[model samples]
Target: MPCRDLPPPPPPAHLRGWLDEAVVRADRARFLSDLGRRSLGVGRLLLLWAVAAVFVLGWSFIGMAWMAFEQHDPFGYVYGLILAVLGAGVLIPAGFWVARGARRDRQVRHLLHAWGESDRDPVADARVRAPGRSLTWLVTSLVLGAFGLWVAFAAAVSARPGDTTYGEVAYTMGIGQILWITGLLGLAKAAAHYRWAVRTFRAPAP
Candidate 1:
């Protein structure tokens, strides 16, 4: 058999470097876009869960109240009524906000899809940070934490040995702890965002 000549060597290092960088940028952009989409999906699911909880728990309380009324049990009626009222108070606004957020997330996802196709710099744009968004979350966490603390205090004051309010008191304390932990997490997130923004802003221009 006749011997065949070998093919020429590969492209130069500089050209290969450029190709590698291009591929990396493309991958990064896709990753950021996918992350944004997943985050939005999770947010929507959480909102839906909240809505379901509000309705289901609220209706359950109201049903209990109705049964108590039929039995002429004043304490049970009042307890259920109070819980039903609290549930109702949280439900209406949460339902509306979830609806709006779902619609907005859908629109943003559409925009993200379009941008990912056309923009080479999609990673930067896909960050999706509002100027004061972190601050807003921090403030909300503070308010919730404070409210939870107050509730816990009240529960502690009302708690007694072999009392009917023991379960309520324990529940309130648990809620307070959860709220405090949530607030701390929010604070940490806000601080991280602040540090990142500062670093990015102060860095020298490329």
Candidate 2:
């Protein structure tokens, strides 16, 4: 007589438990990795902005330096006139650029916090390490940007070649300074948010 085939056996008890735990960890890991990407994304954007700010500041500096070598007061009068036009046009726009980056960084910080505040808290197991590198860049930007602004102010008010020259150099300097500050502020805000995320996640659960 043909015997009926035995039913397939259930998985071993210990193996089943271990498998479930592994699955949980794996799922959490994937989720945390995504979150980390988001956290770092803001930093990357700030970095791009920082580059642009530096470029503008550098180019303006080059223009200011040219005036020093020419030493032709009339040429300076023309330079001052050109700078006044650019100061109002370009410098004003740079302020908005900074505000834009800061706004984006602010929104990102909120998103980072919301991730852990979810009702289920399934991804709490993910750990965040100290963001020393990000912090360094941020602080550097702040200090440098501030110094740049001061330099611009000094240049603008400095003795000019003619009556109309006014503070042409100073105006140009101010624009460069503002550009740097905006980048710095954006980076600093992002670093602060990242630090908070890491600390909050690592803290003992309520």
Pick the lDDT winner. Answer: 2
TM-scores of the candidates are 0.42, 0.49
**Candidates' RMSD to native:** 14.3, 13.8
Measured on C-alpha atoms, candidate 2 has an lDDT of 0.53
lDDT for predicted candidate 1 compared with the true structure = 0.51
lDDT of 1 by residue, 1-206 (tens): 00232122233446656666666555545554453434333343344335545554544454554545445577867876786687577656766865765565444444444433333452364263334555665676577557657766777877887663444555556555545554564456456545544543343568
94-168: candidate 2 lDDT, tens digit per residue: 667657755654554554454443212334434433255456556666666676666776776664677424334
Candidate 2 — which pairs collide? 155-170, 156-170
Local error of candidate 2 at residue 127 (angstroms): 5.9
Query: Candidate 2: misplaced stretches above 4 Å?
Result: 1-107, 118-127, 160-164
